[model samples]
Target: LDGRTVLVTGGAGFIGSHLVDALCEGCDVRVLDDLSTGRRDHVHPEATLFEGDLCDEGVLDAATEDVDVVFHEAANASVARSVAAPRASHRTNATGTLAVLEAARRADARVVAASSTAIYGDPTTVPVTESEPTTPLSPYGVEKLAADHYVRLYADLYGLDTVALRYFNVYGPRQACTDYSSVITTFLEQACSGQPITVEGDGDQRRDFVHVRDVVSANLLAATTDRVGEAYNVGTGDSVSVAELAALVVELTGARSDVVSVDPRPGDITVSRADISKARAELGYEPSVSLREGLTQLVVGD
Candidate 1:
């Protein structure tokens, strides 16, 4: 990554902030974010921050200037939010992605898109692979799948190198502890504050919880690797039920809280895990942190 100028869209968001920090360790990094959901404080001082939306052509051009790689991480992340506001999600996740791709193409920068496991929809298989059929159930999922396809199309038709990383449940420190945020972050915040943990649905719904650190590593690898025009699953390849996750959060934080089950939301999948063989073989990516260890580090903080 040395001497590389990398542009990170949504660089002030949870995963994006971590990615910015990681990129700054060796590369000259620039960040572009609308700050609609991203916090200004999350932006690293080392990064040249452009406070604007990806859909803004001037903003995109400024951010991509002299950039060698682009990491597209901006999106409406919540399925529920997307359900309530499908148009908004499509504008940002789908259209915003096209704008980013155009900027990257203009700059002749390699692109690494932040895709999602939601693209797999309700997977019929235990461990979801990249080759599996993409049957996105929710607007958010469909938007991401479409963006991913655009990435591949651009790579093939326009000669732009692109890679899409289908991230599982990425969670860790700096994750927003808000209503419309990752489950792990939400649970951790509640448990740390000694609040009741709310589990939507039967609590049997499972997810592959990959740490933000590992996800960041995967993003960095994809940026420079030879794996273009392909998608890879970035996860720990392990599944844990929501019930089990809540229990673990309580245990880890030593918080007193009763788990409360609520009605399942729309587009919620019963279970999701990942097959990381493609990432390991192609990008040389492997998760080094266990869930327990990652959770502890997230709670304790460095």
Candidate 2:
């Protein structure tokens, strides 16, 4: 990434900010964010910040100008929020991606866009692959599916160098504990605060949690890999039940919070894990951080 001008949309957000930090030493980085879920303080000191929405043509144009790569990370990432306001989510997640692709196309920049495992919905298989049916259960999943398709379309139709990374449950530092935040963050917060760890629907649902550091590594690889016009699942390829996760969190934090069950939320997948063999073989992507190690860092602020 040296001697490159890279634009990271949503660079003020959790995953994007980490990517920007990694690129700042070798590339001229530009960030475009609306500061909605992301923060101004999260922007790296060396990177230029462009505060705006992704759909704004002027902002997109300015950010992608002379850029070698565009990391499209901005999105309405909450399934519940998308369920409630699908039209708004579509405008941001789906339409926003198209806008970014267009801007990157004009600049002749390679685009690495963020995708989600939600597109698989409730898969019958344990470890879902890229070829799995996109049976999205919610508006969020559908929006991401649309974005993923658009990325491939741009690559095929316009000959744009593009790749879509289908991220699993990504958790790490700087991840806010919001209503839409990851379950790992929520569990950690609850344990630390002496509040009962809430589990939805008996907590049997399983998910593969990948650390943000590994996710960043995958993005970096996607930026330069010769493999284009395709999607790859980025995950540890290992999963654990939510109940087991809560137990582990309790043990890690040494919190006396009781584990309690709650009503199941709609559009929640019962199980999800990634089949990352394609990424491993083609992109040389490997997840180095374990769940315990990543969770420990988050708990202790390492």
Candidate 3:
């Protein structure tokens, strides 16, 4: 990242903040965020923060100016929230992405987008790969799929360098504990507070949890590497059920809390795991953090 001008959209968010920290080593970093879900405190001191919406063309222009690379992480990230508010989610996740791509194209910048495993919907297979057909069940998933397609189209038609990373259950420090945040964060917080962890459904649903640090590494690799017009699954390639995750959180936090089973939530996937061979082979990206180690850090703050 040395001597590079990097623009990180949603840089005040959890994963984006981590990415900003990683890129601040001899790199000029700038952040553009609406702060709807992102906090101002999460914005790194080294980064120039632009308080604006991504949908605005003027805001996009200001942020993309002189940027060598763009990390597009801004999005409405909840499945339930998207289901409840489809139009708002589409505007932010789908339309905002198009705006970002246009800005990147105008600036001739290499772009790395934050896609989700939700684009795969409920995977019938064990380990989902980049080649799997997208069958989005939720509006959030549908919007991301559209965003990924737009990224590929921009890469091919407009000759813009774009790479999309389909992240699977990213969790770590600096993650919010709110309803809009990741499930892991919410569970960890509850467990730490000596509260019973709520498991939506039978607790048999699985997810491939990747540490935010690992996800940041993948983004950095994609930004520097020559791989363009492609999408890679950034994950640990290890599936763990929600029951297992709750148990781990309880162990990590030393919180003696019983797991309570609840009714299943809408638009919830039964299982999700990633096959990260493409990321490993192409970008030399590999998840180095274990769930135990990452969860410990989240609980103990090392």
Candidate 4:
């Protein structure tokens, strides 16, 4: 990305901010975020910030101008919020993605967009591959699927260069600790606060939690690779149950908090492990961070 002009929508958010920080050293990075769920302070000092709604035509126009590549990360990312307000989510996740595609095409720039594993819903198999049929459960999942398909379609139909990354559960610093936050963030907050660590369901539900740094690496690889019009699963190719994760958190944090089971969220996937062989072969992507190391950093860094 050296000497390249890049635009990162949602660059103030967790994953996007990290991407911005990585690109700022060698590329002309411009961040476009609405601040709805993103923090202004998270954006890198070297990058320029364009604060506006992604669906706004004028905002998209200004953000994409003169850009060589665009990382489309802006979206209404909450599943619960999307379930409650599907229309609003559609406008952002689905329609907003189309706007970005059009802008990237107009700018004659390549596009790499963020996708979600939620598009697979509860997978029928253990390690979900890219070829698996999409069976989204929530409105957020549906919208993300729509966005993912639109990106690949634009590449084929308009001859635009585009790639979509179907990211698994991504966790790292700058990830917000909220009711809707990732399980890792929530567990960390609870453990640090000396509160009971809550585990949804029987705690046997498994997930592939990839670190933000690895996800950033995947993005960088996607941008430079000739693998266009295809989607790749970005993950560690490993899975862990919620019960195991909670135990590890307690051990790492050394918190005197009890681990308790709670009601599971409806339609939660029982198991999710990424089949990243395609990413390895095509994008040359590899995950370097271990779950234990990632948790230790969060606990000790705090």
Candidate 3 clashes between residue pairs 3 or more apart in a chain or in different chains: none
Task: List the candidate 3 regions with Cα displacement exceeding 4 Å.
Answer: 179-181
Tell me how far the alpha carbon of residue 21 in candidate 3 is from the true structure, in angstroms, after superposition. Answer: 0.8
Name the better of 1 and 2 by lDDT.
2
Alpha carbon lDDT of each predicted model: 0.90, 0.94, 0.90, 0.93
The alpha-carbon deviation from the true structure for residue 145 of candidate 1, after best TM-score superposition, in angstroms, is: 0.6
Error of 2 at 124 (Å): 2.4
By TM-score, the better pick of 3 and 4 is: 4
User: Compared with the true structure, what per-residue lDDT tens digits does model 4 show for residues 17-78?
Assistant: 99999999899999999999999999999999999998898989998999999999998878
Question: lDDT tens digits, residues 127-172, model 3?
Answer: 9989888899989999999999999889899889999999988888
Residue pairs that clash (backbone atoms under 3 angstroms), model 4: none
| Model 2 spans > 4 angstroms off | 179-181
Give per-residue CA lDDT, model 1, range 1-302, as digits (tens): 89899999989998999999889888899999988889889988999989998889998998898899999998888787888899999999999999999999999999999999989989988799898898999898999999999999999999899999999988888787654238888888788877899999889988899999999999989988876899999999998999999999999888998889988876678989999999999999999999899988977885
Compare candidates 1 and 4 on TM-score and give the better one. Answer: 4
TM-scores, all candidates, are 0.96, 0.98, 0.97, 0.98
Off by over 4 Å in 1: 179-181
Q: Which sequence of candidate numbers ranks them by lDDT, best first?
A: 2, 4, 3, 1
